[model samples]
Target chain A: MNLYANDMLGEPIGLLLSLLIGAAFGFWLERAGFGSSRKLTAIFYLRDFAVLKVMFSAMVTAALGLQLLAVTGRIDLAALYVPESIVWPQLVGGLLFGVGFVAGGWCPGTAAVGLASGKLDALVFLIGAGAGSLAFAPLQPRLADFLHAGACSVGSLPGQLGISGPVGALALAAIALAAFVGATAVERIMAKRIAR
Target chain B: MQRPYWNPYVAGIGLGLTLLLSYVVLGTGLGASGGITRIAATAAHAVAPAAIEENAYLGGYFAEGRPLAYYLVTMLAGVLLGGFGSAFAAKRVAIGVERGPSAPASLRLLFALVGGGLAGLGARFALGCTSGQALSGGAMLQTGSFVFTGACFAAAFAFAPLVRKEWR
Candidate 1:
């Protein structure tokens, strides 16, 4: 019954839901070839558009779904937990993460799937990730300002862009559709180049 | 022979539904790095419990000295298990290093480590990785998620050329 388990622990139902949800998350990831590092990093090479296709579709789907639920009064949008929009850290972290993603060949979620599929490199990557996470402890103090800068916990694209939620969702969907088309074209071009 | 992977769009819908279900049930979305961080903290606690207890970034996870009890931790376990089941059924279970034709296994592993390290650091800085930030927060239309996603892809593309031999 306790939906907000972020600050609490030992909630049996919450933990159970976490397991089931994670199972589905991992299952779909593996199904989408995300368990393969090469497949994941293929986006960088413009060789495979699976990552883009999957990510964009997923984002649009969830965005619309959440909007529908909120609009229908089935769920309260404000109750959902979303991280604050801290621009500085996100920008810096995202840039670093991008490098890591391409070089490492897997993100943390996919890396777990990769490890499960018996990839030795995934195990090593996980060790490194753990070490890196631990490494952040010492630097947290110095990075506090940058980390918390522009912290807007409830900020959304719709609110910032001066549009309604549905409008924003439609715009994102449109963008994703265009991107998907572009992704397919890039894939074809890359495939042709590799073929020759 | 291993079966072919699912279509990206189909699998993506499945993933999205799972995320929606997560939000509906848990009032939150999926995550991976947070779990990894806690697991790392747990290991550190085992080695130097007192040190971890006082760690500025990690100390909060030790409130009950049971970092593994969190939702993300359980979710991580499920991710591993579910991935194994799917891969196993598809006959894709193989123990090996994934790298390009010219890259040595050792070199590939080194990249994996370094890359993973950077990703972990970045995830900590941003408070999430692809799962939490890009997918979860992206669906929520959080502005920073888009920024992070944009930055991540841009940086990856920028770095891809330098690491060309690794995946070519």
Candidate 2:
């Protein structure tokens, strides 16, 4: 049994580990210039693609690495907790989140980084987010059923497609590669247009 | 004098490795909204313990006594410290609002607040945010995460023009 699966690590130790990992995550985010709302919102304006590049590359890397570990019997993929699928709520949430991202210029994670960088807007965003989350408690009663709509037993792409995890990971990596190439081309064209 | 940001691919790899480390060590993934929501719940509980306890959503977090004792809260503290350390070292810290030249400071702040509220609400509905659901679950090849991600980008692209003034 692994640390989380068997509760091998006590809660205190687990929490400590999370802190270290979170530090690393924040370090990379700041290094990527995600601490700047300008840099982040540029993706929406089509002036920059760093957000997509960083996110997709990270996704591909983690996916490939996890799949490799699972194949080698180093980690139990089945024992790991995966987020559940709630199709309609997630879809609607995604749309609202997108609009908010463009309007606010930062997501919850990035806003924290932005706040650290001393952006007052980020602070306001955090307060707003907190209030919004609190608001959910009241709305939860009305939206419980809808929020859990389209809940499915098979959650993963590989599970849904009946493909192996490694195969699915490989496909995702290939797609990320293509997107990187296409993103570069688009940035070039958009830059030229702006220059002209 | 601001230092140039790291190459996106390099940073991405670092982030991916960090995420992989989380899974290997903790059997879970990175998240931010959880921390935020927990803070909110804790605050609410302080003022209205009974009300929060009676609420279905807020009560779930309080069931554990201290809502801020969760992993996400600790991680969030790390995020703040790490972010501050990186920015301080790089001299990227500045006290001001960020907005396009064409946009007024007041307008930008308003947008930030409104947009943040929408995002927070959406994250609650979706059960996660970009980091937790999209990136982590996407790496796990979760079907709904991919769908949520696709919908986010599609909607962002579709609605970006409406908010073009804020960013441009």
Candidate 3:
């Protein structure tokens, strides 16, 4: 399959398709109630689990779909762009991003949704985020070495585990199912406590 | 009043399909932070074209031509339009600051700004945010994505209490 790999669609047309893809992304986010800061932050309060549920589901679905396509030879998995797994910076970055998530009530993507939904705070958050990125520019050189620490030789989880892609995807799906059940239980328990 | 939101699982499937479409058509996953960073770089470039272009981090964005011409920026514009359409259809499009009852609007906005800054900085460190790293790369079962996901949630849960008043 040509699969539009390596910019086969070209820049102008590719960008048009990108716009449609982003529209779909934002559409689902809003439908999932991510446009609301309270709804997003509710996970931190143990008041809701939409974030986890939605995220895990989406991840599992894509993983499984990719595996299936690869197995069927419908697409070449190697053609996809997979970011490297660098441990230290990603771990530290995740920690900081998490705090920001609960505090700001949005990530980069959902913040755009929030802003579109007319949340004034989302606008301020975006500006601050932009400034934050710019702030990191000058420091990039100093942190370059530390940021690249623990770069995994094998990038994908399947490769790291020495398992086939389908197996790895299945494992992830199972984990997601278990987490969904646990998330529901937690939400139920939280609801009961609030009721009292 | 706005209608209720879609079920998480259902919406997630929709999102996943969209991601799959992106991968198939573009051979790349979705992203948001890259666009945000590029926009910042472009704005800074206008004021200090030499300085911005010379900076190690921001300079790379200008290497391929105008930074604003990147696909991520166009996708971001699409996100805004799509979000607006969805919210409008659901009657959820209203101008306001979202916050807890006890929190003042200014305080809420302040927190938003600070929190956004932190998230943005963190995204750059991790090389992506929730969309780019946790979701897009995550779907590909990248080890760093899982690490980032675990650490992000753990840190958020640990720190949520400190800002309890913001959302509680």
Candidate 4:
């Protein structure tokens, strides 16, 4: 399951709430300097770390929040759905996706915002995405086996790693925190070099 | 003047809350590209209704009637509108191409097209985009999502220098 209201047929929300949430999502992304291709790509060049910081911070925030809620028994953790494990396809697909992201300067969602915010490049990108999706149909059978390869069970993190949920969550947080700190140090050092 | 952004940490909390709110309200996480897929599938059906019915993947969304009535499509519409609204309030809205200083506008546009094509292609094989898979699924501690995120970052890092001229 997901975090929005839906009818039995499976819609996410009422139209109005959907728009409001989407706008907020877009607004925050822009405020974080995501609307700019340069800013987004800057992380790759080690010129800016906002993308990593924002993403990691968001991940930790949500993960920790969910973990806390699960512990408190406020929210039914089991009811909340997560994506299933599909290893090989995702690993290969992710590599391809990431390379595309650096080249294009925006992911699917951000590109939507980028286009709306008047980035012509983003518009072109979206069009390409459309074509690409359509193009995948013919090659489907060949990639089909790979796509479904490595089918591990769902919520397989702690179970697969042989740890409790809280422990796994904490470990994730610690790792993210370390990365955050390291990123900050690297940013400072890079800025100093640039200044010099 | 445009209002400044909320701090990254603060924004992260806000986004996280939105995500959490989504789970509480709808019992799932946030997603972006699935909406596109639904819409795209619906649109594709327009041209080939019979073929769509035959195709296992695209046919699933269209089995009912119009694919436009679905939630993901609505969410995506909201994503566009929301993004537009945010850009509007920030005065970040402008009509033009974005490119690196060293790159020509047309060249940048071309790269954007190719890059986007690859991403769209990759997202499907992965079963979702960064929104549906990585951000939403990652927080939920989904194995595939993490794997996907890892590959994406790894690939991006590996290819960043190769495509440096496109953005450098």
Candidate 5:
């Protein structure tokens, strides 16, 4: 059975693996409280740290994991897709997305999970996101230009910052560990205020 | 146990492994908005199949038949189901609007709809949202992803208080 190596249709074994991975991926997202819109959006209110906690934790974990695997010669790192740097559009879009996130109480991903968790507002959010996409169809040309602006897809942190990926990953991990500590402190302060 | 959310660090490790599994098996990272775009394609086709035939963005997604039938849609279905499955397992599922006690329910819904609309539109414009850009791309060390994460938090913090009336 030919595995999904770079593009063409993956073999049946590869396909099944995809589903399994997806199931686990989905399961973990749910277990993290990401399926709840309230929990997911709590970061906006500084009421909960799950979004930042889970997200950064996940990022560091994956970065380190992939780095290790690549270093060990287990997986072909070149085959994986690294998102290109389109600074301006993503920056602006992220800002808009963040506002939408706080306003709607869900991100596109969590919104789906929220719907599954029986939140009607999640369904509304999903429809709203879909409509939002349709709304932008009229502005295609402008969006396209902005999307591909400064399209640099080069890989590795060392090249970008003159440091190895491992070094970068370690730095990120340290930051995450610090954040975890800080978040607990914030939660305690919040709990005290609430208790008072 | 109680409330059933795995430890954030533990769950995050699990999620990272899931992403790594996807990469090893499927050769691509995780994504969410891509699934919604597929749904949009199916809808656009239903209204007028030919109109999409000439469009650039929508056209590429249209396959020989059944553009919506694919990996992203299936994975997304799993996301929803998995969420419900976890909520049920944790006994967290409930019916009611979640909002600050002082706010009117109608106002919350209004803002929710508008906020969701903007998020949807922004995802399309930027070609991603938090999942695709912040989480997935962050894992990959993408500069844009990091930038997006920074922008998102800054914007939300700046705007959250301005609209504090809805929640407070």
Candidate 6:
């Protein structure tokens, strides 16, 4: 049985493993230049598509890989945790996150990377996020209903569309490929305009 | 001189693999905001343990023992170490503020604080941030994640023009 499914590993060991995983995650993010707020914020300007390209590619890869493993009986998809689908909260929260992304030039993860790379602004951003989180704790009681709004059965695209998981994965991969092509085209045009 | 970053696609694949490993091994995906939120809880506990224990959000963290004992908190520490290692190897570690030439440093810092606060609140509302919800949930084909992803990019693009000066 897998560690996650059977509780083969204890909490201390599990947390230790997280360090290695988190390290790899951080390394790749830094290698992608996510440590630089300027590079990350460039996506909003349409001058750089690294954010889109990286995120979409990663999503497609993980989606396809997980489905493949599931289909092959190598892993149990059911055992993996999936976040609940709260539509209204997620949608509105996403909008707010996007605005903050453009304004702060960093998200929670990348901000950590940025701070590691000695970015003072990242430090300030972290502080603000901490403070905001503290503020949220108190406000959570009042916003409980709104946060739970649009509660639905945990949903997946494949399950909702009446398609197989592999098919859904393929569809997402196709979309990602098309988006990459389109994003590159837009970046080229934008760069040319700036040059002129 | 500093080294250039890897190709976006290559880095993307690496990130995807890392995420997959997390799922297979831990039954959960990567996260960041959870750790940060815990820090806030930890601080609140120090000030008013009873009050923190009574709160809905912060209370859950305390229920699990120490607020900082969660997996995400340890992972975040690793993120810091790994990020520093990579940046140091590439000679990219330097203390500075990154902003467009047209934007003043003070304005940029102020925006960062406000924007960070908004993002923190948003993450709480959604129960996840970009990494936890958008990336991880999207891979699982979760419908709300897609909605979150679509709404996020749409809103960002819509408001981008107003904040163009800050970045451009």
Interface RMSD to the true structure, each candidate: 1.0, 1.1, 1.3, 2.0, 2.1, 1.3
Report, for every candidate in turn, its global Cα lDDT versus the true structure. Answer: 0.91, 0.89, 0.90, 0.77, 0.75, 0.88
lDDT of candidate 6 over B1-168, digit per residue (tens): 999999999999999999999898888888898889998788878999998898876787888676776788888898998999999999999999988889999999998998899888888777788889999999999998898888878888888898888888
Q: lDDT by residue for model 6 over A1-196, one digit each (tens)?
A: 4556666333787778888888988998999999999999888888899999999988999999999999999988889877898999899888988888888889999999999999989998888888777877778778789888887774787888889988999999999999999999999999899999
TM-score of chain B of each: 0.98, 0.97, 0.97, 0.91, 0.88, 0.95
Off by over 4 Å in 1: A5-10
Clash pairs, candidate 3, are none
TM-score of each: 0.97, 0.97, 0.98, 0.93, 0.92, 0.97
lDDT of candidate 1 over A1-196, digit per residue (tens): 2286354434877788798889989999999999899889888888898999999999999999999998998888888888888888999999999999999999999999999999999999999999989999999998788889877755798998889998898899999999999999988988798899
Question: lDDT of candidate 6 vs native?
Answer: 0.88
Compare candidates 3 and 6 on TM-score and give the better one.
3
Cα lDDT tens digits, model 4, A67-167, are 88889987877776567778988887798789889888888888888887889898888777766676677678777787778988655587788887778
Error of 3 at B45 (Å): 1.4
Q: Model 6 clash pairs? A: none
Task: Give the C-alpha miss distance for residue B122 in model 4, angstroms.
Answer: 1.1
lDDT of 1 by residue, B1-168 (tens): 999999999999999999998888888999999999999999989999999989877898888766788999999999999999999999998999999989999999999999999999999988899999999999999999998999999999999999989988
Runs of candidate 3 exceeding 4 Å displacement: A1-4, A8-10
Across B28-139, the per-residue lDDT of candidate 2 in tens digits comes to 8889988999997888788989999999878877776867778888888888888888999999999999999899999999999998998898888888899899999999
Q: Across residues A116-179, which tens digit of lDDT does each residue of candidate 5 receive? A: 7777777778887877876777678666777787666564445589787777788889989999
TM-score, chain B, model 1, is 0.98
- The docking quality of candidate 2, as DockQ, is 0.80
Between candidates 3 and 5, the lDDT winner: 3
Candidate closest to the true structure, highest DockQ: 1
Which TM-score value belongs to model 5? 0.92
